[model samples]
Target: MKPSGGSAPGGLFSRLTGFPAGTGGDGVAALSKRQWTRLTAAHQVRAVVAHRWAVVVLALLGAAGAGAVTLAQTPVYSSTVQLVLTANYPAKDIDQVSRGSNYVLQRINTYATIANNSGVAKAVIDKLGLPYSGEQLMANVTVTTHAGSTAMEISVRDTSAQRASDIANAYGAEFPAFVGKLETPDYVDTAPIRVSVTTPATVPAAPVSPDPVANVALGLLAGLGCGLVLAAVRYARVRTVRDERHATEITGLSLLGAPAVDRAAPLLGADRAATPAAEAFRQIRTNARLRAAGQRLTSIAVVGSVPGDDAAAVAANLALTWARAGDTVVLIDGDFRDPSLPGLFGVPNGTGLADMLSAGTPANHALQQVQPELQLFLLAPGTPMPGSAERLLRTNELTKLMESFRRDGAFVVLLAPPLLANADTLVLLSATDAVAATTRVGFTHSDRLAAALQVLQAIRANVLGIVATRP
Candidate 1:
């Protein structure tokens, strides 16, 4: 439906200010925080999808680095020797045996600490005849004890599996003697505590470190997380319109059409009438008509958000689409600095809009009929007058000419200059009944689109919608 005046209902400003849709009032309303969050999240997802290749490459690189490090490291083997500590005092009754078991459990932690001490490491090194010093041997030894039990485990690691096992076994065999000497008193003949080996250390069949599969998997996961963060940052910083949805969100305008990128030809021919590009133009024409259904949509200014947006081609195709539907369409090259409609229509640009406005030339004399069968006419920019183009467009003659076309029941489509590039576009926009903005996918910046819309809204110009075109 056609929006009241020019402001779109539920537009970007309306949504931000929490005002009632289409009111364009100063009153405040409830904010749509949830809707804004959903839009931001959608944009982030699209950004990540657009940079999927970069994410994949990073993950692969991380995995390769992890695999390289894993393969280059030296493999180490581990062996564990289990020991049980017990009370050596004789127990004749069940109560005394229970008391002896309690004593062993209480002293288990102390024995575990001694197992990992430098003194025990030195004894084990001497017994095994190993080259390592007490400090070096203790570095690789680990002692652990179970809760409510006298069982203890002494584990050792080395480059060689056989050496690891020998070191562990030596620690187990020498620990008992060391503990017995420490527990013995000067007045007693025997010690009150005893240490015994319950399980002998064995050579491990596999290394304990540098697992290739696990390292690569972890690296890949870490890299993927980093890539996602980078993608989100890029999305937030670049601020370019990602797609049709992004363009709509930035401009707060309805989507008229999304024509695919076609570089071979700027104008749609009869042979391509059944193609997607032709259908897209037809859709845009239909949507524009629908938006201005109840209003007098006599003149439509086709403006580009920025240069290189191909607004001229869009305007040309839209005129053709209307002309094909049996409407008298007047296509005008309103861009004075760089007139492209003349070249696109294969016509000479001897005299047109500029002469009619500045030199008092008759509008009928400057108009050229390009396609007589389709009832399509063209008006070139005539002479280059970049300096005074804005002044010429501001004259009353342009408004009168548009009214004259409207009286003749002819639809006028003017290819105005890029909004950001020249000020003449604003003049044309003010003179026209409605505007249809053009944006090139992956080329138009979100800030530029928003700025152009702000300019149109300042003048209260009726905006039909936006047409998205690919490069």
Candidate 2:
């Protein structure tokens, strides 16, 4: 993006829009809300779904890397000895009775302190004839209560298993002498409280780390988290509304519950499951209910910009859903060029919409009831039969047909041809209360869809909302 000098560089609308006068990020070409919705819905949303696999791969790599690193490291032996303290040292008068095993855990810290003290480290360093200082020598030592409980252990790590054992013994060997200075026994018994060694540490024959299995497990977990988070963020930021919240945000439409796909014919069920595309249409029905808001909306039309928008499928499923909901539903196949509803419901071709319009057959006579409360009507597409298609759509009889469907308590879903591909959609858009357009990922172009939306806006078509098709 070029810097804004406040003249749009070449007098574009950016200055008028108050965006910086540039031609890239702040350029006139920047996608509008409608275009952004189309672009992101057609691209980013599915990309997030694809990213799950990437996340899994990365997580596995991370785990593998961690494990390989752990395995490749040089082996070191750790020695630990559990100590049992019978009484509190340096403060025996405090109470030996209640202290019990806690005395062992509590006093062990003092013992560790004495063992790793400058004096002890110096002694060990000198005994081993080490070049390192006392502090440096003690840095390798550790003391702790196991599992946040009252059990104490003294730990030391070294490169050699034998040397590790020797260090453990050396620390204990000097511990009593050091503690003797800090506290005296009430009575010097025949046996002095001892710090006997336990589980002398040894260098293992096998490496203790670089676990491939663990790495893979952690990697998978990491990938799942990354994938889920990415999917959520993508879902949240999407401009395309699939639910009620999106209804108000995108087209100012209210949200009704998603209508169920009518499960009547074998083909309809198969079609519903064929691509699992009904959910988008179901949401459209839901938005239709919202757009109707207190007023009656008997004639609901589904439109799009191209073929393969599954406009017919949406019409069928929506009619079935409404029929199932105890409302009469008429599924109108109004795509006068590429009629596809005949095979869907086993209706004969060539004899439906074209014949009805040309013969001046009643609109109700053109309808075919597909289920108990659902009816299927064919508007067979091809060349219009003289004052047929457009005339039928824009007539008082057509209005009366719609009124009859409403009077019969039915919802009508007219499956119209895509706007860009058919003039009939624009012709019908005028008579209908609302329009719902479909956007398929990858197949639908953002800019073109935005232009179509602009056209719809100019005509003031109450665009119910958009239903994005899954890739």
For each candidate, the alpha-carbon lDDT, in order, equals 0.80, 0.56
Model 1: per-residue Cα lDDT over 280-388, one tens digit each: 9999988998999999887899998677787988999999999998999999998777788998888999889889889878867899998767889998888846466
In model 2, the Cα lDDT at residue 301 comes to 77
**Looking at model 1, which ten-residue stretch has the lowest summed lDDT?**
27-36
**lDDT of candidate 2 at residue 163, scale 0 to 100:** 66
Error of 1 at 121 (Å): 2.0
Candidate 2 lDDT, tens digit per residue, 1-471? 121222212232222233432222222234434434443453455556656676566666667666766667666776765554454334465455555456555666666556568887777676777667777668877776544343456677766666665676666566556665555556763222345444444434533344556666776687666665666566445433343333333333333333332324423453453334455445556667776688657777787655665566666666665665567566767766567776687665554555554565665556666553334444444346654565655444445555666777666777776765555565566656677766544444443344445556656777766665443
Once superposed on the true structure, which residue ranges of model 2 sit more than 4 Å away at CA?
Answer: 1-56, 81-112, 130-133, 144-153, 177-220, 227-301, 305-308, 312-427, 432-471
